[model samples]
Target: MPSPVSDIPAATPDLAAAHYAGKLAFETDCSDVRAAFAAGKVDFVLLDVRSPALFQQAHLPGAINLPHGKMTAHRMAEWAKDTLFVVYCAGPHCNGADKAAFRLAKLGLQAKLMIGGMTGWADEGFAFESQAAAAE
Candidate 1:
């Protein structure tokens, strides 16, 4: 019998390539975000779809705290209609990022989830910013 990892036949190379490429249309990762920041090549808006209190405690630098629940078309209109949003929540354990993405889509805005969220950022040894620091 095939080992568990190989029990199911893998997709053909072409299908696998398409599947992975398709996923990139909706998802990004902490490492890529960091690299964009480091290179000053950020072309998207980064949103923290977490509560105000949690966001005040800690959040990704350059991320704007706009909890998913408050994502209205009016609020989002603050940005240009063509702005691309990248959203993240607390971690993989949370679905706030997904909710935010859904809301953005419903409002006819472009969005992508930053996979792994804050947990992934921490895992990558990234520095975080707090609301207090942002004031200064």
Candidate 2:
């Protein structure tokens, strides 16, 4: 089987170090993600590569919805070149994040996959936000 990170675009030094150090790797433990959020180390964009309806139901707060299919076009204009991106899909088995990460890398954005995705986030009891809800 192909490594999950194989499809991802160029890895930034932080991500590369994380890969070697086993930090910032795609993890099923959402607590780490929450901690990153709490520490303000996650200044990158959080992207939901799921469908519109799924996104409307629930998503990470501050996550920008950029369904995978739209990523190759102008919709990606919402993000800046220097923006670091954390992409997620439905779950670990899902490859949407990998594909999105590849696209982001092709576009020259620094990107990484959240690995465990939303299911992991929900399992960890981390907070979620709806499209209509305001960000904290």
Candidate 3:
């Protein structure tokens, strides 16, 4: 017969904290996120946290340009609480998305990182919107 103590399962909360500290809580792979966008299930904000020049060059369709350095709670308030905000930067080496996600989280908003950033988004061959299209 199993001992009474053996029946108890180990709680992962403590271990998980150590493993997840200094890392993003929600990390969605590029393909999954792309599929969600294609299926129209992703109605959340796709925030581009890169520089203005990079943003103007090209960005995911429907993405809002909010450079990481300039992000403020007031500016982010435009989005609804229920909205699922997805943040991205230039590439894997970039930390802008992480910063943006943290800021959003501090404001009591839910934010997730697009794991590979815009470079991965571009590699997926997803269409991007530009200022020209917005004006048209």
Which pairs clash in the backbone of model 2? none
Q: Which regions of candidate 3 fall more than 4 Å away from where they truly are?
A: 1-25, 133-136
TM-scores, one per candidate:
0.95, 0.71, 0.73
**Best-fitting candidate, scored by TM-score:** 1
Cα misplacement distance, residue 80 of candidate 1 (Å): 1.5
Model 3 TM-score (2 dp): 0.73
Candidate 2 least-lDDT 10 residues: 23-32
Q: List, in order, the clash count of every candidate structure.
A: 0, 0, 0
Ranking by lDDT: 1, 3, 2
Residue range 21-122, candidate 3, lDDT tens digits: 645557765787778877988767888999888888788776788987777878877877777788999879899999998888888888889898888877
Work out candidate 3's RMSD over C-alphas: 7.1
Give the whole-model CA lDDT for all candidates, comma-separated.
0.96, 0.78, 0.80
State which candidate, 1 or 3, has the greater lDDT.
Answer: 1
TM-score for predicted model 2 compared with the true structure: 0.71
Candidate 1's residue-wise lDDT over 1-136, tens digit each? 8999999999999999999999999999999998999899999999999999999999999899999999998899899999999999999999999999999999999999999999999999999999888899
